[model samples]
Target chain A: MIAFGILAIVALIGGIGVIVARQPVHSALFLIVNIVALAIFYIILSAEFLAAAQVIVYAGAIMVLFLFVVTLLTAGKDDEEAGEELSGQRITAGVLAILAGGGLAVVGVLYPSQRIQLGLPQNFGNLRGMGDVLWGPDFVYLAAVALMLLTAAVGIMVLNRPPRKKADPEARLKERES
Target chain B: MMLLQVVLLVIKIVLLIAILMGGFAYTMLLERRLLGFFQLRLGPNRVGPGGFLQPIADGLKMVLKEDLMPDGADRFVYRLAPVIALFTALSVDAVIPFGAAIHIFGLTVYLDIANPSIGLLIAFAFSSLGVYGLVLGGWASQNKYSLLGGIRASAQIISYELAMGLAVMGVIMTTGTANLYKIVLYQQHHGWLWLPQIGAFIIYFITGIAETNRTPFDLPEAESELVAGYHTEYSGMRFASYYIAEYINMITVSGIAVTLFFGGWLGPWLPPIIWFFIKVAIFLFVFIWIRATLPRFRYDRLMNFGWKFLLPAALIYFLGTAVFVSGVL
Candidate 1:
């Protein structure tokens, strides 16, 4: 009821926030907010696990990676290296975002979520159900993804580890405890 | 109908502002006291007993202080930066359930402003929005130190937020809900969510500190390097916005932690609000304690930790929880 109004407001604000942020990095961050808000809308619709997964996958995994890569490349200096000129890339992103957002709005107006979802158990699609599906039917696939995640995690660890340096007192204490 | 909604929204905004500003005022005093405790010394007993009114004095001073902007600053964005930072900080509460639903007259009123179905995501979204303040604040200041610091913040938060999100995902896996109240309810029937998901707790806690620009993980505002970092150029209420935002954010983080892990408003003896506040305070103490004890992380190390350590751990935890859930449920 009232919840829909609030989500609409949040989505609108977050959408504007994406545009309002002066930097691409900032804009990217705002998009995280928009996405998360959308995920929360999913939660309100009783798609509980989907909402969490949305934050987990999109906000946690994708956006952070996006921010990290952006920062790593740009943190070396200000973004002026790409030239102060508002290049074609900016125009393209703007048009694409506008078209997508406008198109979505039209869709919403055309069809305002009429099909009622039945038997949406409170915890459906949560880690529990997700696990049921994963182990029952999707175990092999999940295992492969697990292997991939492991490889990626290991790869990142190997890539990002600091050069061996003098251990801190805390590290020494920890080692001693272990 | 629209008018009523507008009025309600305005009231919520006002209440939010009051809570934040009030919390910010007391948080200064609380932090100093906490810092002093960690250092084993009495702190700030000068103005009032135990510096009870120190924040008031501090606010008065900040308000009266020079509102200076460094030269060559981006006039528009520089000024706009604080507002954005402050707004995003305050906006997260639109969905967070402060306490259980309460009845006033005939209306069943929940303390949270928005409480949108996707409440958790709204909070995360606002958190992501927060990085802009740091970036714009730094870029607008025109100081090289500020620029570098701001750039670091841009990089660091964006990087760490990923790990943070994953950590939260682990929680999502367990509770299977995104609405704060539901998350809390999920926590209530089960054991404290943190016990089973220790890895998620650690990752989430560490990255949360980074997200909120707190100590140890606080490379963006590294005092030794950037001379207040992104906030070098801000003063008065503008500066207050950043500090205030940080404290309010501290409350938000603590509140979220309580909801997600500590069983929000479920403890007996006291009312739900009291339990929520107490839990939040405990975490807030942990924040201050960590600040007092730990050394700041080098910038590169912060990124490495996020990517290498926290993210992977969160993923593993999520998978384990999911499997466990599959077996049990």
Candidate 2:
């Protein structure tokens, strides 16, 4: 419980830092802190596989790409100098955030009994258990998620494909003859 | 009794750190001496018998030198980078089982620090995080070359990491566990996984070399182009920190490779820990041998090989392993 409290504070600070840090790279790093803290929370909850996956996927891979892109393109650039392209965006975002938070708070207060129990099964968080869950009854959901990610990747590839050059009629004839 | 256990653990940790530090120093000397021998030249032999004390002199010089922070550099991140590097490097050792459990004061303690179920994944996580140190150090240096080095290092590590992970899938599937200790025990009963999973071993070695940023894949610090790469702007102990991180990473990868494929800590007429170190030493020798034998890969060629060759090969091998493990073969 003490560990939970400390990690909760860390996660909150990291979350605040993500938005407050001026540099994009710094913000990405703060996001990593938040992600790592969340990963530890998974461990405390006895989700060892989930915790490792969380760090590997979020803090390790995704955040590295985020930092790579930010450092590559936004080095020395001041974030505040970029004027908002959408008018009244900040006000709209603030209102939406408050509404989301209020909704979540209401849900928590109304359904406190929905909380998960601390006791878990013996094989609840090992690799074998994860494998069984993914490949057993929940296989379809895993496949669906994987297929969606694949489709998105292929879509990006198509979008980024180089422009095709027009084939000359003479060159076509020569190629056919050859 | 509980307090004694805690104290013993603390002592074990301190001893491990000391051994690793000594290992790092000797490894550096070995690389230098071997590189000289490969080139038909005498290596550093002046400091002590056969250059044994060279690392001590080098350490002193590093500590005594001035620490430089470039103008306009991010001072906070600049200092934080080396700490991150050393921290991640050291932490990876926590999960590596170097020997069988031994009885001490009526307590059965394993030779490693922790024996988590996700031991392999923890090592992977730390290795993946290792890139941040180089990336941040390069970026904080405020030098364009340093930034380029950092970016290159991240891209290289990330690209090879996919194949590396896949390369170990065969062993993981065979053992049906990610626990390092279990993997080694399985190897002891069966033969070393390397003989059966030769392709995976080769892929792992190639990717490991690239991940370590060692020679042949040493483009991260390619002196010909990036001027010492990510650590170009760093000086003194900061520079040594990066150096130590690299060497320690080499040791960690070698340890993992031995644990996974080389029948770790298993041999005739030798202590388990001694056998483990011998295996790791051989891996280190191969690392240095490859350094001496091959030139650094061209940037495009490196990426092309990693993505085009290694990734597909690893995927195919992994699928085959899955089939075999499923009793389809």
Candidate 3:
């Protein structure tokens, strides 16, 4: 319980830091900390597979992508002077952030009244159980997810394709002049 | 009884760390000597008998050397990077089984630190976390070369990780478990999964090399191009931390390879621990040999190879294994 409490607090602070941090890279680092805290929470809940997946997928692969993009674009130059031009916009964001935090706290307080047990079965978080869920009755859902990911990949490829020579006005004009 | 168990656990942890540190030291010496012979030269033989105490000398030098940090570098993250690297590298060993549990003096002792049910996934997760160290170090250094190196490392790791994970799926499918101990036992009964999962094994080994950023995939640290890459600005013990992390990661990869494909600790006549070390040593030797033999790959070519060839091949092998294991083949 103490571990859970500590993790929860750290995750909460990390979540706040993600939005509050001026530098994009720092924000991404905060997100990583938040993700790691969540993974620990998964472990404490006996969802060992989920915890590992959380680290591998979210904290490892996805966050690497996030940090790469952040570093490539900004390179840690997003200081306070360059951030948020309008005061009204900042005020609105602050109000929304507070609302979201309060809403989450209210949900947490009310969740236990629903009598939903968080305790999982002995095998529920094991690889066997995860495989059964993925490949058994929910096979169609898994297939759908795979199909969606494939479509997204194809979309990226199409978006990234080199422009046709004929489609380039400068090239067409040069060809005509030649 | 509980106190005895705790004591045993403490002992195991200490022994594992000591052995791993010693292993890392000797592995460095072996690599230097082997690389020297491969290139027709004698390597570092003056420290101790046949350079046996070379790592100790190297460690002392690193400690005595001045710690140099680039001006305008992010000091906190710069310092944290090597710690993150070494931590992830060492912690992944928790899931790897060196051998089966043995009974000693009316007590049971497992060979590894912790054998979680999702041991395979945990190992992958921890290994994957090592990328953060490279990326953060590069970014923190405030150098263009370091930043580029970090970016390259992250991209390479992310690309190859998919192939690596898919390759492991084949073994997991065959064994029907993700636990390393269970997988090893299954391999013993089934005469090693490598025969049936040859394609997966090959892909796994290649991806393992790429994951650890060895030669051919060492574009991140391509000395000719990036001037020692992301670690160019680091010095002294901080530099040594990254060096130690890389070697430890090499060992961890070899251990995983042995456990998954080579049948962990399961040879005849010899003890299981000895067999395990022999297997890991062979893999480590192969790692060094590949580094000596192969030239570094171009960044674009490396990315293309990983995504185009390795990923698809691993996917095909994974699906094939799944189908065969399900008795539909």
Top-scoring candidate (lDDT)? 2
Candidate maximizing TM-score: 2
Q: What is the CAPRI rating of model 1's predicted complex?
A: incorrect
Q: What is the DockQ of the complex in model 2?
A: 0.59
lDDT of 2 by residue, A1-178 (tens): 8999999999999999999998888888899999999989988878889888988888788888888888898666453667778999999999999999999999989988755766887667667778889999999999999999999999999999998754798887887899
For candidate 1, give the lDDT of residue B48.
Answer: 85
Root-mean-square deviation of Cα positions for candidate 2 versus the true structure, in angstroms: 3.0
Candidate 1 lDDT tens digits, B165-210: 7778767767776678888878767778888878888888888898
**DockQ scores for all the models shown?**
0.12, 0.59, 0.72
TM-score of the second chain, each candidate in turn, equals 0.94, 0.99, 0.99
| Per-residue C-alpha lDDT of model 1 across residues A1-178, encoded as one tens digit per residue | 7988888888888899887765666677578768877987977766656776676567655765575555444443343434646659878998999999999999999989977876666457654566678778989999999999999999998999998865698887887799
TM-score of 2: 0.95
- The alpha-carbon lDDT assigned to residue B91 of candidate 1 equals 80
The model with the greater lDDT, 1 or 2, is 2
Q: In Å, what is the interface RMSD of model 2?
A: 1.3
Q: Is the docking of candidate 3 incorrect, acceptable, medium or high quality?
A: medium
Candidate 2 has an fnat equal to 0.49
List, residue by residue over B29-141, the lDDT tens digit for candidate 2. Answer: 99999999999998899999999999999999999999999977988889999999998999999899989998877789899988998799989988889999999998888
